[model samples]
Target: MFTSTERIKPDAQTIALYLENVLSHKYQIPTFQRDVVWEKENVKKLWDSIYKFYPLGSILVWKTNTKLESHREIGGIKLADNFHSHEYQYILDGQQRTTFLLTSIYGNKIANKKNFNPTLYIDLTIELTNVTDDISYAKRFLFWDEIDDRDGQIQANTGKKKPLQR
Candidate 1:
């Protein structure tokens, strides 16, 4: 059997842009797909791999006319309401990675096991240090509430706090 498939290797920024489009209802996730289930640690590791230019693996989408009830919000971003189309690309895989990317970059909250939504934040301070190799890179992920106090604590412990570059 012969099939036509296209493979694209887009940079992180481009991927982010596409996700923004998804939020806008330009694409849809079929109801059959699982909900976002990546834990906080997993989300952080995904970002770390991307930051290091490590391949996170390819996303699989199916182009079809099938329209199903899709997510109204993903990772706490309120998507446009029930905008349907005759043509849709159903996300068959990479749901977790896509959710993490959307939530982390857009500063959206994710649902925890207790059903509480917590906002995600990347420690800009830690990311900067790692990028410059000024200190041993330790993967750090923080929630919105902990960011302010945690930065100081990290500095005190590591003695490697530097101003974040613009």
Candidate 2:
């Protein structure tokens, strides 16, 4: 007993496409949606999941002809306004995930955080071995600050060569 409007279908989108839409303002967050609140550790975990090819869950979007007030920015990244389109897709959930993806890739200027660099780095030198409960990915995935600290030690040891990739 499903009508056309009631039927739901799943669509797969690449990270590139998602980010493009975010930059273009095709995807919008409703005004009622909560602000970005995820800390650095939380962001690291999310990127870790992606690096392992794990499912990052779905972002629910509601398409409607009715336009509603939406957030123009997330984590200091400004989204363009789409006035030509009569239809809009408002994100009903997945605000945190969306924000993380946007901020990590686009960088952010979070309040009270000085010189926050949301850039994520992965150590290609790290070997992939058999998983154990004691094993951690902390060394493999790092933030800018962590890499900076390690870079200082590495620079002092044998000249300078960054190990992490952007």
Badly placed stretches (over 4 Å) of model 1 are 1-13, 111-119, 124-139, 145-151, 155-166
Error of 1 at 53 (Å): 0.8
Residue 87 shift from truth in candidate 2, angstroms: 0.4
Q: Candidate 1 lDDT, tens digit per residue, 99-126?
A: 7778666655655444433445556655
Worst 10 residues of 1 by lDDT: 155-164
Query: Candidate 2: global Cα-lDDT?
Result: 0.71
Residues 51-150 of candidate 2 have per-residue lDDT tens digits of: 7788999999988898888877766666556544688888898878887787777777654355667666677666557554223466666676675545
Top TM-score prediction, candidate number: 2
